[model samples]
Every structure is written in structure tokens, then in C-alpha cells.
Target: MSLLADVDFRRYWLARMVSLTGSLVTYVALPVLIYSVTGSSLWTAFVVVAEGVPYLCFGLFAGALADRLDRRRVMVIADLVNAVVLGSIPAAWAFGVLTAPHVLVVAFLTQILFVFFDAANFGALPALVGRARIAAANSAVHGGGTVLEIIVPGLAGVLITLTAPAPLLLVDAVSFAVSALLVRAIATPLQTGVPGPPGGMLRDIREGVVFLSRHSIVRTQTVIGCLQSMTGGAFMGQFVPWLDQTLGIRPTNDARLGIMYGVWGAGGIVAAVLFPRLSRRLGEPRVTLWFLPLSALAGLACGLATNWVVAAAMLGLWAIVYSMVVLTAITLRQRVTPDRLQSRVNTAGRMISFGVGWPVGALLGGLVSEATDPRTAIIWTAAMTGIGVVFAWLSPLRRLAGEPIPDADETPTPAQREPVPAPDRIEA
Candidate 1:
């Protein structure tokens, strides 16, 4: 069946899209609020630091907990928590008691909640869709959000100026509430069985790590995924300045910048729509092996292009290749992982890929851009992705290329058997 034709998936897709669109508004608004309130670049930098710290600190625990609890219940409670906290920004602003620290605290709190929400969500999607449609389901959810990402950031910028950043976050609060309702409305099971008393949290987390570290394809894809996130973060970090430095499109040129962003988003949209097909035809391993080099080449091309036209096209192509690598790695991890370990294992990997890799890459790219020019920095980061390509060629992933995905039955293994009986498949 077509993914959208499935009633619960349709609701699930809309819930994710709605939450993403709202957050995109906050993404711009929160920074604007901080700057307007504190007027300190250091405080502004704290916002970025605050967002990443929660992911690193709480990511694994959230995942471990999700696996032991009812995932959908966890998601719903998280959304409600997010709604109250996010709504606080506007509430404080209305009473004229808003401060920079208040906004910053809200920023940190919201992100912490996101770590939990996202952990539960990672598990919930696979449970809702089942294994057969995992790739397509992932694409549909990401594709919808990518489309919003293209449209909403620009609109959020405009809305910030018009409605003020503080008032605008209410939209985010409302979105979270709506998301909670939608998630609750789903008629399908979000887990295979009701969770029993979990073992030691540390022990549960260890099991996830040992499994990830031992499984070759899953391990290889995750390591490559970390590398991709790092370099991709580094590459994008220098993107704006590279445009100004190479093609003479200054930061103030919104029309040209908007078009460039739209072009990049279009590339993401194309990749998201096509990745499932690519995975089916080429297999996930081959897709990653083939595309890793293309991403590096495309990144290098963008760095080399002095003309705006060439730069734009290369950036679009780079986005496609780059996004596909990330998506395929995620799909591979989810496909191999048992449902019981889905949240813990996937979140553990993300803690490395996103929590650690992204911030580090941005910091490294910034340092490079400082030492040299943005153009040179872009080239350096592009070259960095070649590390992933080389590793792919040497790793077990290379041999797995062109092989079909294993059946779902083959996925659940004796290696990590739980004492819990076969799941009764009840709604949480």
C-alpha cells in the first residue's frame, strides 16, 4: 500500500511535519530573542552550546528508558512537557518579565525534552510502520519536514520581525499540543508488547552498545554516519561565507541567498523522495559505498566553483548525495536492530553522529575558516568526507554491497534475547 494511504502513517507524518514546522520558527526566533535581550555574542553562543549538551548528557538514558516504557506514552508526555515549557517564553514575554537567561534556560530545557521525544519517536516509527515499509516511511516523514524546512525558515524570519520572536513561540507550543493529540489518536500499536520491569538501566544501555559494536554492517554504517555528520556539518558551517567569498553573493543579498537555500532544499527533497528507490535497486550498502565518493566530489566542486551558477548546481548535487548517505545509514541501522533495541541503539548512535559530530565539525570548520579563507575551508571539509569513503572501501560494508536486506525474522536474534515472551501486541 502507498504509505500515505495508511491512516496511522498519515497522522504520524502530519504530526512530525507540524512539530518540525513549528520548531523551524523557534529555530530562528530563539536566536533573535537572545540577541535582542542580551546583546552579547557569548550569550548567543551559549544557546548553541546549550542545545548540544542535553543530547550528549541525556541521549542514551532517554533511549534506554524508551525501550523499557511505553514508547507512545513517552512521546505524548514529552510533547505535553514541551508545550508547557515552550509556551513559557511567550508567557514571560507577555508579562514583561522576559530576560536573556530565561530564554536561554528555555532553550536548554526544550532541547533536553527533544532528546527524550526523539528517542521515543525513533522507536515509535518502526513499530507503527513495521519493517517492510521502514525506508519509505522514513523518506515520507523526512521529505515532508524537508519541504517545511525549505519554506518555514524564511517565513519565520519575516514573522520574527512582524510579531516579535517571543510571541511567535506560541505557535511552537500549539504545535506540540497538536502533535501530542495526533500521536495519541493513532489506532495501531507503537510497541510489540507491554514492557515489564526493566533491568538495571546501565545494563540495558550496555547491551545496546555491545550489540552495535559487534554487528559489522550496523557498526560500519554507524561509524561512517558519524564521519558524514562531522564533515557535512563542517562543510555547511562555511557555506554562507564561501558563497560571499567565491561568488560575490554577500550575506545581505537575501534574494540570491534565498534562491541558493531553496536550491539546496530542492536537492534534499529530491534525495528524500528517491532514496527508498535507490536502496531497493542498489541495496543500502552499495548506495552508501557509491554515494560517499560522489558527496566528496560534489563538495569539492562547490568549493572550486567561482561562478554563482556552478556553485549553486554543485551545492544542490552535494545535498542529494550527502543526504542519501545519512538516510541510508539510518535505515540500515533500523532495519537490522530488533524492535526492543530500536530506541536505545539508534539514540546511542545519534549521540555520536549528531550530538558529538555536528558541533565538533562546525567548530573545526570555523577554526579552518579562521586560519584560511572560507573557500579553502570548504575544500578542506569536503576532503574530510573522503575518510568515510576510504573506510567504506575497507570495511565489511564493501562486501555487503548489492546484497538484499535480510528478512525481519532474521533480524531478531538469539544473541540478545529478552526474557519477555513473544509480544502480545497490545496498545500502550
Candidate 2:
């Protein structure tokens, strides 16, 4: 059966669609809101940094917890928590109590909760659809999000023009509540691995970290992912200001900006549709290796484009190759990770790529923007992506280019299994 035909997978997809559609609004609105409040590029970037900080602080714990608890329950609770947390934003705005710090705190807390939600989500799909369908399943998820990326930002730009960005967050809050109900209705939990003997949470997290560190392909790809994310975070952190100062686009005159965002997402849609076919032909690792330089070139073009139209086209092209890298990386991680360690290992990898990488990039982008110009900062960000190209050659991903991912039914060799600690030394 096709992955979409699976009842549980369908529910999960819808839940993701609803929540992410709303989030696309907030993603645009948050920066617009911050820029409106502070009028400082640095502060806006700082808020973006705040969004990633929680991932660093709590990622491993959240991932470990998702493995120990019912993944569905973790996702459900996370949605509910996010609803309450995001709802507070508009509530504060209504009372004239909103501040930059308030917004920063909300952004941080929401991401912390998201760490758990995402950890559960990363593991759930493979369990629901099986290893053979990982690429297709992820394509659907990424494709849906990309579609929203195309639609939501244009709508959000219009809405932000008509109304304030603060009120739009309420929509995000409501969407989360709805997503919780949908997630709760999924009959089968995705991460339904047989329960192992109880290990301390720290121990569980350690096992995941060890697995990632020791696996050659996983380790190498993960580092490359971090570099890619750093560039990505920098681009996003500066995109709004770049639009305003470089292209004369603003929340009020947002058509050009919305179009750029939509075009980029459209590129992602193209990537998602083509990824499975490409992987079949070139192998997943080869796709990553080949696309990395293309992605960098796109980034370079994005930084250098003087005309908004040219910038939008470059960004759209960049999105295609960049999304391919991201989707392939996630699929690689999911395909190889043991079922029991799925959430923990996946989340640990993301902690580096997203949690740490994003903040560092954002901070550097902000500094560069403040020190020089937004355009130059963008160029620097693009230049940073080239580092990944160099790393790829040295990484195991180069060696693993044509290897097929092990099938789910295949038993792992003794070395591939996770190591166990002796009982006496084990912590409670």
C-alpha cells in the first residue's frame, strides 16, 4: 500500500499540515513583529537565536524522553503546550504588556517543546510507513510544508498589511490545539519498539550520542548538516532585513518579499517530487555530494543579485538543491538508526545541525549585518556553505555514495547493535 493510504500516516500528515501551515504564518510574522518592535536588525536576529537556544539546552533530553515515553503522547502534549505558550503572545499584546524579552521567551519555550515534538515526529514516520518508504513519506511531509511555504507567506503578508503580526500568532495557537486532537486520534504509535530494560535518561542520551559519533556516515553527514544549517539560519535571520534594505520590500510593501519566499518554497516542492527518482539513479549520498556545490552557487547568486526579481529566482533555485540536501540527510539518518534509538539519535544529530548551528549562524549574520551591510552578510553566509563542499570530500558520505540502506527486516551485525552497560555501573 502507498504511504498515504496508511490510516495512521494520514492522520500524522494532516496534523503536520495543520500545525505547519499555521507556523508558516508565525515564521514570517515573528520576524516582522520583532522588526516592528525593536527596529533593530541585531535584535531580530537575536530573537531568531533565541528560537534555537532551547534546542541546544534540551534537545538530548527531549529526544531521550521521546524514546522512553509514548511518542504519540509526547507529540500530543507538546502541541498542547505550544498552544498555551504561543497563545500568550497575543494575549500579552492585547494587554499592552508585550516586550522584546517576552517575545524572546515565548520563542525559546516554544522551541524547547518543539524539540520533543520533532524528536517523536522524526521517528514516527519510519515506524508508520516502514524503511522502504522513508523517502516517499518524507517527501510528502516536506512537500506539504513547502506548499504551505508558497501559500501561507503571501497570505500572511496580506494579513500583516491588514492587521498586526501579533494577532496572527493566535492562529498558530489554535492550529496547535487542532493538531493535538488529530495526533491523539492516530490509533498506532510510530515508535512502538519493544521496551528495553530501564536505562537512566542520561544513559539513554549517551547511547544515542555514542551511536552518532561512532557511525562514520552518520557522523560525517551530521557535521555537514550542521554547516548547511548554519548557512540556512543565517539566510533566514537576515532575509527580512535584506528584503527591506536591499530590495525595498517591507511588511507593508511585502509583495516582492512574499513572492521570494513562495518561490523558494516552490523550489522545495520540486526537490521533494524529484528526490526519490534522483536517489534511485545517483544514490542518496551522491545526490548530497553533487548538490552541495549547486546549493552554494545558488546562495552566492542570492547574495549578489541586485534586482528583486533576480534574487527571487536565485532563491527558488537554491531552495531546490538545499531541500534535497536536507531531505537526503534526514533519510540517511532514519534508514540506519536502530528502531529503539531512532528518536534519540535523530534528535541528537539535529541538536548539532539546528540547535547549535542555527544560533551561531544567526548571531554571526546579525554581527555581520550590523558591522557591514545586509548584502555583504548574505554573501558571507553563502561563502560559509562552501565549507561543506570541502568537508564532504573528507567525510564518509563520499565512500557510502552507492551503498543501499539496509532494509528494515535485515538484522544488524554485532558491531552495528548498541552497546550495553553492565548492571552494577548503571545509574537509576
Candidate 3:
């Protein structure tokens, strides 16, 4: 059967699209809700910090859980949990129980569940689609989700005008429920190839870390990823306030940020769709090497912008290149890692890279933006991201263009097993 004809894939894709649209709605509504309650930029930053901190704290544990349990069940549970939590916001508001503290608590809770959902979703993909199709499958998912990014903000804007942001939370809740049902309908068990370590969760976590540290490619990729995320986080955390304060554009009035994000999502979708063929042509590593610098330049451009239009355009460029870089990175990681260790390794990578760096960078950005000019903060962040381009150019990963990926049919040779370490531990 044609890949497009795969029943499970179709069901899962449809579900994700529906849920993503709703998520887009909340992404807009939540901020608006928070801003309406407290008209302070610091509170806005606090909300951002609240959302990011939990992911940093729980990312590794969530990944280990994905490795140990049925990923599908985990995903379903996460979706349902999110649905219920998000669904409560509107109800609370209607009952006059909603407050700034309530919004903060709900935002924190929703993000925590989101991290689990995200980890399980990635962990489950290999089992559902098989390793060979990972790039294409991921591309399709990213592409479909991008399409929604373009539409959802406008939809949310319309909804917000007609009703309070509370009712929009119900839409998010419904989306999650639908996603859960669709995920549950898939009958295929996610094939976890082998268990990593037998002892406690600590041991299992340690083994995963040791494995990643030992792998040169994984180690380098993780380091670069971390740097990229740190810089990206700093920029994103500041961009809203920067635009609002420096450009004299209010967040609600200027939907250009949403447009910029949609453009970025479009870039990612385009990269994902074209990556397989591009990898075949330019070679995966070479493509990354070429694009890495371009992405940095895009960041630099975003920093230097003085006008809203220029800033939005620069952000769009950055979004496009950044999407390509991420798609390539994820594809390479998925291709190289063994099936059994994929979740552990992916989690470890994220834990060290994005999970850790995002909050730190964002917190720093918030502080810096408050202390100095937001544009200055953005420029520094952009400069830092550009510096990573030199590292990429010097690494052996740069020379890996057109190299043939190992055939999946080959069995993985047994490597020395390391003792499991404690949970939430990260190395390299």
C-alpha cells in the first residue's frame, strides 16, 4: 500500500492537525488573557518563564518514561490530561474564580503535560512509521502543522473578538480529546527494540547518558543543538517585548509576530518536504553546514532591523533557515541512533540542549531586556548564534555531505553496556 494510504498515519496526522489548530488558538488567546488581567510586561515574561521551566525540569524524566512504557498510552494520557486542564480554564473564569495566579497555575500545568505529550509523540513515531520513513513522516507532520500556523491565529483573533479567551480554551480541550481518541484507535504496538538497563530509573537514565557521551556524532550534535537553542530562546523571549517597546507596536495590534512565526513554520515544512531529496542531492551533513551559517545570518538580520516590516521579514528569513537546520538535525539523529536507544538519546540531547538552555536563556533575556534595550539583547543573541556557525564549519559533521546512511537491515553490534545512572542526570 502507498505510504499515504496507511490508515494509522492518516488517522494520526488528521488528529494532530486538529489539535495543532486548537493549540494555535490558545497560543494567541492565553497571552491576550494574561495581558488583559495584568497589563505588565514582567507578568508576560513570567508566563513565558512558567511555561519553559517545567520542560527543563521534567524533560529527561518524561523521555525515560517514554522509553519504559507504551508510548501510545503515554501520548493518549497526556492528551486527555491536557484537554481536561485546559478545559478547566474557561469554566473557572465563568464561575468568577479566575485570577492572575490561576492563569499562571494553568499555564504551568498545561506546559508540563505538553512536554510529556511532545516526548511521547516523537518516541512513538519510529514505531508507527518505521525508521526508513521517519524523514518523510516528520516532514508531513511539520508541513501539515505549518499550514495550521498560518490560519489559526486569524481564527483565534476572530474568536477573541466574538467571545472571551476562556471559551477558546474549550476548543483546545476538544482538540486534545479528539487527538487522544485518534491515537487510541491505532492498533499497532510501538516496537521498543531493547531495554537499556534493568535496575532503577537512575541506572536506566545513566546508561542512556553514557551511550550518548560515547557517540562522537551524537555528542557534537547535542552541543551544537544546545547552543542553537540557547541563542534562539534568548531572541524569542525578548522579541515580543522588543517589538512592543522599541517598535511601539502593541502585541495585540501587531499580528505580524504571528505572521513571522507562520513564515518560520512554513520554512520548516518546506525544508521537511524537500529534505529527503535535498539530502540525496547535497548530502545531509553538507546541507546542514551550508544552512547553519545562513541561519545565523538570518538571526543577525533580525537583530539589526529598525522597523516592524524589516524585523518581520528578517524573522521570516531566520525562521526558514532555522526550520531547515532543525529538520536536518532531527533527521540525522533519528537516522543514526539505534531504535531502542532513540528515546533515551533524544531526551538526553534535548535535556542538555533545549530543555536546559531555553529557560536559562529566556530568563536571562528577560532580565537583560529589562535592564538594557531589547534590541541590544536581540543583537547580542544573534551574534552568539552566528558564532556557532564557525563551530559547524570546523566540525567533521560539515564534511558528511552525500554520505550514504547505513542500511537499516544491518543488526547493531553489541557495545559495552554502562551502568544506569540517576534520573534527571545529564552528561556531555
Best by TM-score: 2
Error of 2 at 15 (Å): 0.2
Q: Rank by TM-score, highest first.
A: 2, 3, 1
Question: What would the per-residue lDDT of candidate 2 be over residues 1-428, giving only the tens digit for each residue?
Answer: 37778888888889999999889888989999999999988988988899888888888998888888888888999999999999999999999999999999899999988999999888888888888888889999999889999999888888888888999999999999999999999998577675445569888999899878876667777898899988888888998989988987875656766787789889999998999899889888899899999999999999999899889889999999999999988998888887888898899999999998898999999999999888888899889889999999767677667566554356544433334465422110
lDDT of residue 134 for candidate 3: 83
**What TM-score do all the candidates reach, one by one?**
0.85, 0.95, 0.88
lDDT rank, highest first? 2, 1, 3
Q: Write the per-residue lDDT of candidate 3 for residues 1-428, one digit (tens) a residue.
A: 25558999888888789889888888777867876788755566666677777777887777777777777888889999999899889999989888888888888898898878777776677778887888788778878887787677666766666678777889899999999999999877765664334347776667677767865456667777777777777776665577677776565655564665566566566666677787768766777788888887888788888887887777767877787777777776676666666677787787777776666666677677778877777777777766568887776575444355452344322221223466633322
Report the alpha-carbon TM-score of model 1 versus the true structure: 0.85
Task: Give the range of the ten consecutive residues with the poorest summed lDDT in model 2.
Answer: 419-428
Model 2 residue 13 CA deviation in Å? 0.5
